[model samples]
Target: MTNLKLTRFAPTPSGFLHLGNVYSFIVTYHLSKKHQAKILLRIDDLDRERVKNRYIEDIFDTLNFLELPYDLGPKNLKDFKSSFSQSERMGQYAKALEILRQSKLLFACDCSRKKVEKMHPKGYYTGFCRNRKLPFDQNETSWRLKADMHQDISFKDLNEGHIVGKLPGILTDFIVRKKDGLPAYQLTSVVDDLYFGVDLVVRGKDLFGSTLAQVFLSEHLGPNAFAQNTFYHHYLLQDPNNQKLSKSAGATSIQFMRKSGKKKEDIYMMIGEWLGVKERIKSLEEFGRYV
Candidate 1:
Protein backbone atom coordinates (compact mmCIF):
# COMPACT_ATOMS: atom_id res chain seq x y z
CA MET A 1 0.00 0.00 0.00
CA THR A 2 1.17 3.55 -0.69
CA ASN A 3 2.11 5.56 2.38
CA LEU A 4 -0.58 8.10 3.14
CA LYS A 5 0.18 11.71 4.09
CA LEU A 6 -0.17 12.43 7.81
CA THR A 7 -0.67 15.85 9.41
CA ARG A 8 -1.18 16.74 13.04
CA PHE A 9 -2.86 19.60 14.89
CA ALA A 10 -0.97 19.88 18.16
CA PRO A 11 -2.39 22.29 20.73
CA THR A 12 -1.09 22.82 24.23
CA PRO A 13 -4.05 23.02 26.57
CA SER A 14 -2.63 25.79 28.69
CA GLY A 15 -5.35 28.23 27.65
CA PHE A 16 -8.51 28.57 25.58
CA LEU A 17 -8.31 28.48 21.77
CA HIS A 18 -8.07 32.03 20.45
CA LEU A 19 -8.54 33.48 16.95
CA GLY A 20 -4.93 32.72 16.11
CA ASN A 21 -5.53 29.10 17.04
CA VAL A 22 -8.66 28.98 14.90
CA TYR A 23 -6.90 30.48 11.88
CA SER A 24 -4.08 27.95 12.14
CA PHE A 25 -6.60 25.14 12.45
CA ILE A 26 -8.46 26.38 9.36
CA VAL A 27 -5.21 26.41 7.44
CA THR A 28 -4.21 22.96 8.64
CA TYR A 29 -7.64 21.51 7.96
CA HIS A 30 -7.83 23.02 4.49
CA LEU A 31 -4.33 21.87 3.57
CA SER A 32 -4.90 18.36 4.92
CA LYS A 33 -8.12 18.10 2.99
CA LYS A 34 -6.36 19.37 -0.10
CA HIS A 35 -3.90 16.48 0.05
CA GLN A 36 -6.43 14.03 1.50
CA ALA A 37 -3.99 13.43 4.36
CA LYS A 38 -4.85 11.72 7.60
CA ILE A 39 -5.14 14.22 10.47
CA LEU A 40 -4.29 13.69 14.14
CA LEU A 41 -5.29 15.82 17.11
CA ARG A 42 -2.34 15.74 19.47
CA ILE A 43 -2.87 17.57 22.74
CA ASP A 44 0.42 18.95 24.06
CA ASP A 45 -0.46 19.00 27.72
CA LEU A 46 3.12 19.14 28.98
CA ASP A 47 2.92 22.21 31.16
CA ARG A 48 1.59 20.64 34.32
CA GLU A 49 0.97 23.86 36.18
CA ARG A 50 -1.03 25.57 33.44
CA VAL A 51 -2.71 22.60 31.64
CA LYS A 52 -6.27 22.23 32.91
CA ASN A 53 -9.19 19.92 32.16
CA ARG A 54 -11.28 22.89 31.08
CA TYR A 55 -8.71 23.86 28.47
CA ILE A 56 -8.63 20.30 27.12
CA GLU A 57 -12.39 20.32 26.93
CA ASP A 58 -12.25 23.67 25.16
CA ILE A 59 -10.02 22.14 22.49
CA PHE A 60 -12.49 19.32 21.72
CA ASP A 61 -15.47 21.66 21.98
CA THR A 62 -13.95 24.23 19.64
CA LEU A 63 -12.90 21.60 17.08
CA ASN A 64 -16.36 20.04 17.20
CA PHE A 65 -18.00 23.45 17.01
CA LEU A 66 -15.95 24.31 13.91
CA GLU A 67 -16.34 20.81 12.45
CA LEU A 68 -12.57 20.45 12.08
CA PRO A 69 -12.26 16.68 12.05
CA TYR A 70 -9.29 14.46 12.86
CA ASP A 71 -8.54 10.80 12.07
CA LEU A 72 -6.71 9.97 15.29
CA GLY A 73 -6.52 11.00 18.96
CA PRO A 74 -8.45 10.57 22.17
CA LYS A 75 -12.20 10.62 21.65
CA ASN A 76 -12.82 11.99 25.12
CA LEU A 77 -11.14 13.09 28.37
CA LYS A 78 -10.71 9.50 29.60
CA ASP A 79 -8.82 8.46 26.48
CA PHE A 80 -6.78 11.65 26.60
CA LYS A 81 -5.69 11.11 30.20
CA SER A 82 -5.09 7.42 29.60
CA SER A 83 -3.58 6.86 26.15
CA PHE A 84 -3.19 10.12 24.21
CA SER A 85 -1.49 12.13 26.93
CA GLN A 86 2.19 13.00 26.40
CA SER A 87 2.83 12.17 30.05
CA GLU A 88 2.26 8.49 29.26
CA ARG A 89 4.92 8.47 26.53
CA MET A 90 7.93 8.78 28.80
CA GLY A 91 9.40 5.40 27.83
CA GLN A 92 9.48 6.36 24.17
CA TYR A 93 11.25 9.61 24.98
CA ALA A 94 13.68 7.72 27.21
CA LYS A 95 14.56 5.35 24.34
CA ALA A 96 15.27 8.29 22.03
CA LEU A 97 17.34 9.95 24.74
CA GLU A 98 19.27 6.71 25.11
CA ILE A 99 20.08 6.80 21.41
CA LEU A 100 21.32 10.38 21.72
CA ARG A 101 23.25 9.47 24.85
CA GLN A 102 24.86 6.42 23.23
CA SER A 103 26.10 8.65 20.45
CA LYS A 104 27.64 11.07 22.98
CA LEU A 105 25.34 13.81 21.74
CA LEU A 106 23.60 14.27 25.10
CA PHE A 107 24.85 16.13 28.19
CA ALA A 108 23.50 17.28 31.54
CA CYS A 109 23.48 20.93 32.56
CA ASP A 110 22.38 22.68 35.75
CA CYS A 111 22.94 26.26 34.61
CA SER A 112 20.24 28.72 35.58
CA ARG A 113 18.70 30.80 32.79
CA LYS A 114 20.13 34.02 34.25
CA LYS A 115 23.60 32.51 34.51
CA VAL A 116 23.51 31.17 30.95
CA GLU A 117 22.44 34.63 29.75
CA LYS A 118 25.21 36.33 31.74
CA MET A 119 27.80 33.86 30.37
CA HIS A 120 26.86 34.44 26.76
CA PRO A 121 25.92 38.05 26.28
CA LYS A 122 25.00 37.25 22.69
CA GLY A 123 22.30 34.86 24.08
CA TYR A 124 23.51 31.37 22.98
CA TYR A 125 25.16 28.62 24.97
CA THR A 126 28.76 28.28 23.77
CA GLY A 127 29.39 24.84 25.30
CA PHE A 128 29.96 26.02 28.86
CA CYS A 129 28.84 22.60 30.08
CA ARG A 130 29.82 20.58 27.05
CA ASN A 131 33.05 19.48 28.74
CA ARG A 132 31.89 19.99 32.33
CA LYS A 133 30.27 16.51 32.20
CA LEU A 134 27.59 17.31 34.73
CA PRO A 135 26.13 14.43 36.72
CA PHE A 136 22.91 12.76 35.54
CA ASP A 137 20.31 13.43 38.19
CA GLN A 138 16.77 13.94 36.99
CA ASN A 139 16.03 16.28 39.90
CA GLU A 140 19.20 18.35 39.53
CA THR A 141 19.98 18.90 35.84
CA SER A 142 18.52 19.23 32.33
CA TRP A 143 19.55 17.09 29.37
CA ARG A 144 20.64 19.24 26.42
CA LEU A 145 21.46 18.22 22.86
CA LYS A 146 25.01 19.02 21.76
CA ALA A 147 24.38 21.06 18.62
CA ASP A 148 26.86 21.17 15.77
CA MET A 149 28.81 24.42 15.56
CA HIS A 150 28.44 26.51 12.38
CA GLN A 151 26.29 23.91 10.58
CA ASP A 152 23.71 25.12 8.06
CA ILE A 153 20.23 23.60 7.87
CA SER A 154 17.36 24.63 5.63
CA PHE A 155 13.91 23.42 4.60
CA LYS A 156 11.27 24.40 2.07
CA ASP A 157 8.25 25.94 3.76
CA LEU A 158 5.04 25.97 1.76
CA ASN A 159 4.46 29.66 2.40
CA GLU A 160 8.00 31.05 2.81
CA GLY A 161 9.67 28.94 0.11
CA HIS A 162 13.29 28.03 0.99
CA ILE A 163 14.14 28.96 4.59
CA VAL A 164 17.76 28.47 5.72
CA GLY A 165 19.85 29.24 8.80
CA LYS A 166 22.93 28.19 10.77
CA LEU A 167 22.52 26.00 13.81
CA PRO A 168 23.68 26.88 17.42
CA GLY A 169 22.90 30.40 16.24
CA ILE A 170 19.22 29.84 15.49
CA LEU A 171 18.99 26.83 17.84
CA THR A 172 21.66 26.52 20.47
CA ASP A 173 21.99 23.57 22.84
CA PHE A 174 18.29 23.14 23.63
CA ILE A 175 16.79 20.92 26.29
CA VAL A 176 15.60 17.45 25.33
CA ARG A 177 14.52 16.52 28.83
CA LYS A 178 13.68 18.76 31.76
CA LYS A 179 15.09 18.60 35.29
CA ASP A 180 11.83 17.12 36.51
CA GLY A 181 12.32 13.91 34.45
CA LEU A 182 9.70 14.93 31.87
CA PRO A 183 10.45 14.95 28.15
CA ALA A 184 10.74 18.48 26.72
CA TYR A 185 8.54 19.77 23.90
CA GLN A 186 11.29 19.55 21.27
CA LEU A 187 12.00 15.92 22.09
CA THR A 188 8.43 14.68 22.49
CA SER A 189 7.13 16.44 19.39
CA VAL A 190 9.86 15.01 17.20
CA VAL A 191 9.49 11.52 18.64
CA ASP A 192 5.74 11.55 18.15
CA ASP A 193 5.98 12.84 14.57
CA LEU A 194 8.65 10.30 13.70
CA TYR A 195 6.81 7.39 15.30
CA PHE A 196 3.46 8.35 13.80
CA GLY A 197 5.01 9.02 10.36
CA VAL A 198 3.74 12.58 10.04
CA ASP A 199 4.77 13.94 6.66
CA LEU A 200 3.18 17.37 6.97
CA VAL A 201 3.25 19.91 9.81
CA VAL A 202 1.26 23.17 9.86
CA ARG A 203 1.77 25.61 12.68
CA GLY A 204 2.22 29.33 13.40
CA LYS A 205 5.10 31.29 11.86
CA ASP A 206 6.41 32.16 15.32
CA LEU A 207 7.47 28.49 15.57
CA PHE A 208 9.86 28.76 12.64
CA GLY A 209 12.72 28.74 15.11
CA SER A 210 11.26 25.61 16.69
CA THR A 211 10.88 24.00 13.26
CA LEU A 212 14.59 24.45 12.64
CA ALA A 213 15.48 22.95 15.99
CA GLN A 214 13.24 19.98 15.32
CA VAL A 215 14.87 19.46 11.94
CA PHE A 216 18.29 19.45 13.58
CA LEU A 217 17.24 16.97 16.25
CA SER A 218 15.70 14.71 13.62
CA GLU A 219 18.95 14.70 11.63
CA HIS A 220 20.81 13.55 14.71
CA LEU A 221 18.29 10.76 15.31
CA GLY A 222 18.73 9.29 11.83
CA PRO A 223 18.28 9.93 8.12
CA ASN A 224 14.91 11.33 6.97
CA ALA A 225 13.43 11.39 10.48
CA PHE A 226 11.88 14.76 9.56
CA ALA A 227 14.02 15.71 6.59
CA GLN A 228 11.33 14.59 4.15
CA ASN A 229 8.41 16.29 5.86
CA THR A 230 6.59 19.34 4.48
CA PHE A 231 6.13 22.33 6.77
CA TYR A 232 3.71 25.27 6.50
CA HIS A 233 4.30 28.13 8.91
CA HIS A 234 1.29 30.32 8.26
CA TYR A 235 0.82 33.98 9.18
CA LEU A 236 -0.36 34.59 12.73
CA LEU A 237 -3.57 36.42 13.64
CA GLN A 238 -2.43 39.54 15.44
CA ASP A 239 -4.22 42.17 17.45
CA PRO A 240 -4.55 45.89 16.67
CA ASN A 241 -1.28 46.47 18.57
CA ASN A 242 0.42 43.90 16.30
CA GLN A 243 0.70 41.39 19.10
CA LYS A 244 -0.14 37.74 18.33
CA LEU A 245 -3.51 36.71 19.77
CA SER A 246 -2.85 34.89 23.06
CA LYS A 247 -5.09 33.14 25.54
CA SER A 248 -3.32 34.77 28.50
CA ALA A 249 -4.34 38.19 27.20
CA GLY A 250 -7.98 37.03 27.08
CA ALA A 251 -8.08 38.08 23.43
CA THR A 252 -11.26 37.02 21.62
CA SER A 253 -11.37 33.38 22.74
CA ILE A 254 -13.59 30.93 20.85
CA GLN A 255 -15.30 29.98 24.11
CA PHE A 256 -16.24 33.59 24.69
CA MET A 257 -17.35 33.98 21.08
CA ARG A 258 -19.56 30.90 21.36
CA LYS A 259 -21.01 32.20 24.62
CA SER A 260 -21.81 35.46 22.79
CA GLY A 261 -23.95 33.44 20.30
CA LYS A 262 -21.52 33.76 17.36
CA LYS A 263 -22.22 30.93 14.95
CA LYS A 264 -19.72 28.98 12.87
CA GLU A 265 -20.81 30.96 9.81
CA ASP A 266 -19.59 34.17 11.47
CA ILE A 267 -16.10 32.69 11.85
CA TYR A 268 -16.15 31.27 8.31
CA MET A 269 -17.07 34.67 6.86
CA MET A 270 -14.33 36.34 8.90
CA ILE A 271 -11.76 33.83 7.64
CA GLY A 272 -13.04 34.15 4.08
CA GLU A 273 -12.58 37.91 4.25
CA TRP A 274 -9.10 37.42 5.64
CA LEU A 275 -8.24 35.03 2.84
CA GLY A 276 -9.40 37.66 0.29
CA VAL A 277 -12.26 35.49 -0.93
CA LYS A 278 -14.85 37.77 -2.56
CA GLU A 279 -17.85 35.63 -1.60
CA ARG A 280 -19.04 34.92 1.91
CA ILE A 281 -18.37 31.39 3.16
CA LYS A 282 -21.60 29.76 4.33
CA SER A 283 -19.84 26.89 6.06
CA LEU A 284 -16.47 25.15 6.44
CA GLU A 285 -17.41 22.90 3.53
CA GLU A 286 -17.84 25.96 1.28
CA PHE A 287 -14.62 27.52 2.61
CA GLY A 288 -12.76 24.29 1.85
CA ARG A 289 -13.78 24.63 -1.78
CA TYR A 290 -12.09 28.05 -1.95
CA VAL A 291 -8.91 26.94 -0.21
Candidate 2:
Protein backbone atom coordinates (compact mmCIF):
# COMPACT_ATOMS: atom_id res chain seq x y z
CA MET A 1 0.00 0.00 0.00
CA THR A 2 1.18 3.54 -0.77
CA ASN A 3 -0.32 5.17 2.36
CA LEU A 4 -2.70 7.19 0.16
CA LYS A 5 -5.35 9.46 1.64
CA LEU A 6 -7.83 10.19 -1.16
CA THR A 7 -8.88 9.51 -4.76
CA ARG A 8 -11.93 10.47 -6.78
CA PHE A 9 -14.51 9.46 -9.36
CA ALA A 10 -14.54 12.57 -11.51
CA PRO A 11 -17.24 11.95 -14.09
CA THR A 12 -18.44 14.39 -16.70
CA PRO A 13 -22.19 14.79 -17.19
CA SER A 14 -22.10 15.48 -20.92
CA GLY A 15 -23.50 12.01 -21.57
CA PHE A 16 -25.07 9.04 -19.82
CA LEU A 17 -22.84 6.74 -17.75
CA HIS A 18 -21.33 4.12 -20.02
CA LEU A 19 -19.69 0.79 -19.14
CA GLY A 20 -16.37 2.51 -19.67
CA ASN A 21 -17.37 4.96 -16.94
CA VAL A 22 -18.44 2.09 -14.69
CA TYR A 23 -15.14 0.34 -15.32
CA SER A 24 -13.33 3.46 -14.17
CA PHE A 25 -15.50 3.62 -11.06
CA ILE A 26 -14.81 0.00 -10.24
CA VAL A 27 -11.07 0.54 -10.59
CA THR A 28 -11.16 3.68 -8.48
CA TYR A 29 -13.35 2.01 -5.90
CA HIS A 30 -11.12 -1.03 -5.56
CA LEU A 31 -7.88 0.95 -5.62
CA SER A 32 -9.16 3.23 -2.88
CA LYS A 33 -10.01 0.19 -0.81
CA LYS A 34 -6.63 -1.38 -1.42
CA HIS A 35 -4.79 1.76 -0.37
CA GLN A 36 -7.21 2.65 2.45
CA ALA A 37 -7.95 5.91 0.70
CA LYS A 38 -11.31 7.62 0.77
CA ILE A 39 -13.25 8.07 -2.49
CA LEU A 40 -14.77 11.39 -3.54
CA LEU A 41 -17.48 11.66 -6.17
CA ARG A 42 -16.39 14.72 -8.10
CA ILE A 43 -18.72 15.44 -10.97
CA ASP A 44 -17.21 17.53 -13.79
CA ASP A 45 -20.23 19.44 -15.05
CA LEU A 46 -18.36 22.43 -16.41
CA ASP A 47 -19.22 21.74 -20.04
CA ARG A 48 -22.48 23.67 -19.83
CA GLU A 49 -23.48 23.20 -23.43
CA ARG A 50 -23.74 19.41 -23.17
CA VAL A 51 -24.40 18.95 -19.44
CA LYS A 52 -27.91 17.77 -18.63
CA ASN A 53 -29.78 17.14 -15.40
CA ARG A 54 -30.68 13.67 -16.59
CA TYR A 55 -27.02 12.84 -17.14
CA ILE A 56 -26.15 14.03 -13.65
CA GLU A 57 -29.04 12.02 -12.30
CA ASP A 58 -27.76 9.01 -14.20
CA ILE A 59 -24.44 9.24 -12.29
CA PHE A 60 -26.15 8.78 -8.95
CA ASP A 61 -28.59 6.25 -10.36
CA THR A 62 -25.83 4.14 -11.88
CA LEU A 63 -23.72 4.25 -8.72
CA ASN A 64 -26.67 3.20 -6.61
CA PHE A 65 -27.68 0.54 -9.10
CA LEU A 66 -24.18 -0.96 -9.06
CA GLU A 67 -23.90 -0.51 -5.27
CA LEU A 68 -20.75 1.58 -5.63
CA PRO A 69 -20.24 3.89 -2.64
CA TYR A 70 -17.96 6.84 -1.97
CA ASP A 71 -16.60 8.32 1.26
CA LEU A 72 -17.08 11.97 0.26
CA GLY A 73 -18.79 14.47 -2.07
CA PRO A 74 -22.39 15.19 -3.11
CA LYS A 75 -24.88 12.47 -2.31
CA ASN A 76 -27.40 13.51 -4.94
CA LEU A 77 -28.22 16.04 -7.62
CA LYS A 78 -29.49 18.66 -5.16
CA ASP A 79 -26.41 18.25 -3.01
CA PHE A 80 -24.12 18.59 -6.02
CA LYS A 81 -25.91 21.70 -7.32
CA SER A 82 -25.90 23.30 -3.89
CA SER A 83 -22.27 22.66 -2.97
CA PHE A 84 -20.14 20.34 -5.09
CA SER A 85 -20.70 21.88 -8.51
CA GLN A 86 -17.52 23.03 -10.27
CA SER A 87 -19.28 26.27 -11.22
CA GLU A 88 -19.13 27.16 -7.52
CA ARG A 89 -15.33 27.22 -7.72
CA MET A 90 -15.04 29.91 -10.38
CA GLY A 91 -13.14 32.24 -8.08
CA GLN A 92 -10.46 29.63 -7.39
CA TYR A 93 -9.93 29.02 -11.12
CA ALA A 94 -9.75 32.75 -11.77
CA LYS A 95 -7.23 33.13 -9.00
CA ALA A 96 -5.01 30.45 -10.56
CA LEU A 97 -5.38 32.09 -13.98
CA GLU A 98 -4.22 35.36 -12.48
CA ILE A 99 -1.17 33.65 -10.99
CA LEU A 100 -0.34 32.19 -14.41
CA ARG A 101 -0.88 35.61 -15.98
CA GLN A 102 1.48 37.24 -13.50
CA SER A 103 4.11 34.60 -14.31
CA LYS A 104 4.20 36.10 -17.83
CA LEU A 105 3.80 32.59 -19.20
CA LEU A 106 0.38 33.11 -20.73
CA PHE A 107 -0.76 34.64 -24.02
CA ALA A 108 -4.16 35.55 -25.42
CA CYS A 109 -5.19 33.71 -28.60
CA ASP A 110 -7.97 34.69 -31.04
CA CYS A 111 -7.67 31.79 -33.46
CA SER A 112 -10.75 29.79 -34.42
CA ARG A 113 -10.81 26.04 -35.15
CA LYS A 114 -10.94 26.63 -38.91
CA LYS A 115 -8.13 29.15 -38.71
CA VAL A 116 -5.97 26.76 -36.68
CA GLU A 117 -6.56 23.95 -39.20
CA LYS A 118 -5.65 26.29 -42.03
CA MET A 119 -2.42 27.16 -40.24
CA HIS A 120 -1.47 23.53 -39.64
CA PRO A 121 -2.86 20.77 -41.84
CA LYS A 122 -2.56 18.28 -38.95
CA GLY A 123 -4.80 20.56 -36.84
CA TYR A 124 -2.15 21.03 -34.14
CA TYR A 125 -1.83 24.56 -32.79
CA THR A 126 1.20 26.21 -34.40
CA GLY A 127 1.44 28.87 -31.70
CA PHE A 128 0.11 31.30 -34.31
CA CYS A 129 -0.98 33.90 -31.75
CA ARG A 130 1.99 33.59 -29.42
CA ASN A 131 3.39 36.98 -30.45
CA ARG A 132 0.07 38.53 -31.55
CA LYS A 133 -0.18 40.19 -28.11
CA LEU A 134 -3.98 40.07 -28.12
CA PRO A 135 -5.63 41.52 -25.02
CA PHE A 136 -6.71 38.88 -22.50
CA ASP A 137 -10.04 40.70 -22.14
CA GLN A 138 -10.66 40.72 -25.88
CA ASN A 139 -13.92 39.12 -26.95
CA GLU A 140 -13.61 35.51 -28.16
CA THR A 141 -9.95 35.28 -27.11
CA SER A 142 -8.66 32.31 -25.06
CA TRP A 143 -5.71 32.32 -22.68
CA ARG A 144 -2.99 29.82 -23.56
CA LEU A 145 0.06 28.85 -21.57
CA LYS A 146 3.43 29.59 -23.28
CA ALA A 147 4.70 26.03 -22.91
CA ASP A 148 8.40 25.14 -23.10
CA MET A 149 8.37 22.30 -25.58
CA HIS A 150 12.00 21.38 -24.86
CA GLN A 151 11.60 21.11 -21.11
CA ASP A 152 11.04 17.65 -19.65
CA ILE A 153 8.05 17.00 -17.36
CA SER A 154 8.31 14.18 -14.85
CA PHE A 155 5.71 12.71 -12.48
CA LYS A 156 5.36 9.60 -10.30
CA ASP A 157 3.31 6.79 -11.76
CA LEU A 158 1.88 4.35 -9.22
CA ASN A 159 2.32 1.43 -11.59
CA GLU A 160 5.38 2.34 -13.65
CA GLY A 161 7.25 4.55 -11.19
CA HIS A 162 8.81 7.82 -12.43
CA ILE A 163 7.80 8.81 -15.98
CA VAL A 164 9.33 11.64 -17.97
CA GLY A 165 8.15 13.25 -21.19
CA LYS A 166 7.80 16.46 -23.09
CA LEU A 167 4.53 18.15 -23.92
CA PRO A 168 2.63 16.35 -26.65
CA GLY A 169 2.39 18.28 -29.93
CA ILE A 170 -1.41 18.32 -29.83
CA LEU A 171 -1.42 20.12 -26.47
CA THR A 172 1.16 22.73 -27.42
CA ASP A 173 0.31 26.07 -25.85
CA PHE A 174 -2.89 24.50 -24.56
CA ILE A 175 -5.73 26.74 -23.49
CA VAL A 176 -5.96 27.61 -19.82
CA ARG A 177 -9.09 29.68 -20.15
CA LYS A 178 -11.61 29.29 -22.96
CA LYS A 179 -12.86 32.16 -25.11
CA ASP A 180 -15.96 32.19 -22.92
CA GLY A 181 -13.66 33.26 -20.05
CA LEU A 182 -14.26 30.01 -18.20
CA PRO A 183 -11.24 27.92 -17.17
CA ALA A 184 -10.39 25.03 -19.46
CA TYR A 185 -10.27 21.38 -18.33
CA GLN A 186 -6.48 21.26 -17.98
CA LEU A 187 -6.46 24.26 -15.66
CA THR A 188 -9.58 23.42 -13.67
CA SER A 189 -8.54 19.80 -13.18
CA VAL A 190 -5.28 20.78 -11.48
CA VAL A 191 -7.03 23.43 -9.38
CA ASP A 192 -9.80 21.07 -8.31
CA ASP A 193 -7.43 18.26 -7.36
CA LEU A 194 -5.43 20.66 -5.19
CA TYR A 195 -8.62 22.22 -3.78
CA PHE A 196 -9.88 18.83 -2.60
CA GLY A 197 -6.47 17.54 -1.41
CA VAL A 198 -6.54 14.50 -3.68
CA ASP A 199 -3.22 12.57 -3.44
CA LEU A 200 -3.87 9.55 -5.61
CA VAL A 201 -5.30 9.83 -9.13
CA VAL A 202 -6.55 6.86 -11.11
CA ARG A 203 -7.71 7.46 -14.66
CA GLY A 204 -7.62 5.73 -18.05
CA LYS A 205 -4.36 5.50 -20.00
CA ASP A 206 -5.87 7.67 -22.74
CA LEU A 207 -5.39 10.69 -20.45
CA PHE A 208 -1.65 10.08 -20.17
CA GLY A 209 -0.98 13.15 -22.29
CA SER A 210 -3.36 15.17 -20.16
CA THR A 211 -1.54 14.00 -17.05
CA LEU A 212 1.72 15.37 -18.45
CA ALA A 213 0.03 18.61 -19.49
CA GLN A 214 -1.51 19.13 -16.06
CA VAL A 215 1.80 18.40 -14.34
CA PHE A 216 3.50 21.05 -16.48
CA LEU A 217 0.70 23.54 -15.84
CA SER A 218 0.89 22.90 -12.10
CA GLU A 219 4.57 23.81 -12.04
CA HIS A 220 3.67 27.34 -13.20
CA LEU A 221 0.82 27.63 -10.68
CA GLY A 222 3.41 27.86 -7.89
CA PRO A 223 3.62 25.29 -5.09
CA ASN A 224 0.67 22.87 -5.28
CA ALA A 225 -0.06 19.31 -4.13
CA PHE A 226 -1.16 18.26 -7.63
CA ALA A 227 2.44 17.87 -8.80
CA GLN A 228 3.28 15.56 -5.90
CA ASN A 229 0.26 13.32 -6.30
CA THR A 230 0.83 9.79 -7.65
CA PHE A 231 -1.09 8.60 -10.69
CA TYR A 232 -2.33 5.30 -12.16
CA HIS A 233 -3.43 5.12 -15.78
CA HIS A 234 -5.43 1.94 -16.21
CA TYR A 235 -5.95 0.17 -19.51
CA LEU A 236 -9.13 1.10 -21.35
CA LEU A 237 -11.94 -1.15 -22.43
CA GLN A 238 -12.00 -1.07 -26.22
CA ASP A 239 -14.58 -2.18 -28.77
CA PRO A 240 -14.21 -4.92 -31.39
CA ASN A 241 -12.86 -2.38 -33.87
CA ASN A 242 -10.09 -1.48 -31.36
CA GLN A 243 -11.71 1.87 -30.57
CA LYS A 244 -11.96 3.00 -26.97
CA LEU A 245 -15.52 3.19 -25.69
CA SER A 246 -16.94 6.68 -25.50
CA LYS A 247 -19.97 8.24 -23.80
CA SER A 248 -21.16 9.39 -27.22
CA ALA A 249 -21.35 5.73 -28.22
CA GLY A 250 -24.87 5.29 -26.86
CA ALA A 251 -25.01 1.55 -27.19
CA THR A 252 -22.48 1.06 -24.37
CA SER A 253 -24.30 3.32 -21.94
CA ILE A 254 -25.36 1.70 -18.66
CA GLN A 255 -28.68 3.56 -18.82
CA PHE A 256 -29.47 1.86 -22.11
CA MET A 257 -28.51 -1.51 -20.70
CA ARG A 258 -30.61 -0.99 -17.58
CA LYS A 259 -33.59 0.08 -19.66
CA SER A 260 -33.13 -3.01 -21.79
CA GLY A 261 -33.49 -5.28 -18.71
CA LYS A 262 -29.84 -5.86 -17.71
CA LYS A 263 -29.04 -6.52 -14.07
CA LYS A 264 -25.98 -5.40 -12.17
CA GLU A 265 -24.63 -8.93 -12.32
CA ASP A 266 -25.09 -8.97 -16.06
CA ILE A 267 -23.18 -5.72 -16.30
CA TYR A 268 -20.31 -7.10 -14.23
CA MET A 269 -20.26 -10.25 -16.35
CA MET A 270 -19.99 -8.21 -19.53
CA ILE A 271 -17.09 -6.19 -18.14
CA GLY A 272 -15.34 -9.30 -16.87
CA GLU A 273 -15.66 -10.85 -20.29
CA TRP A 274 -14.27 -7.75 -21.86
CA LEU A 275 -11.31 -7.85 -19.48
CA GLY A 276 -10.88 -11.54 -20.27
CA VAL A 277 -10.85 -12.55 -16.63
CA LYS A 278 -11.07 -16.27 -16.23
CA GLU A 279 -13.40 -16.23 -13.25
CA ARG A 280 -16.95 -14.96 -13.56
CA ILE A 281 -17.55 -11.58 -11.92
CA LYS A 282 -21.01 -11.18 -10.34
CA SER A 283 -20.43 -8.27 -8.00
CA LEU A 284 -18.11 -5.37 -7.25
CA GLU A 285 -16.33 -7.36 -4.54
CA GLU A 286 -15.59 -10.13 -7.02
CA PHE A 287 -14.39 -7.57 -9.55
CA GLY A 288 -12.02 -6.07 -6.97
CA ARG A 289 -9.94 -9.25 -6.90
CA TYR A 290 -9.06 -8.80 -10.58
CA VAL A 291 -8.51 -5.07 -10.27
TM-score of each: 0.89, 0.98
Which pairs clash inside model 1?
none
User: Per-residue lDDT tens digits of candidate 2, residues 1-291?
Assistant: 688999999999999998889999999989998999999999998887999999999999999999999999998999999999999999999999999999899999999989988887777899889998998899999999988567799999988899998887788899999988889999989999999999999999889889999999998888777888999999998766777899889989999999999999999998898888888899998987777
Worst 10 residues of 1 by lDDT: 162-171
Each prediction's whole-model lDDT (CA): 0.81, 0.91
RMSD of each: 2.7, 1.0
Cα RMSD for predicted model 1: 2.7
Using lDDT as the measure, the top candidate is 2
- At residue 199, candidate 1 shows an lDDT of 88
Candidate 1 local lDDT, 119-185, one digit each (tens) = 8777677668888987777456989998865777788676566778766453588889888778889
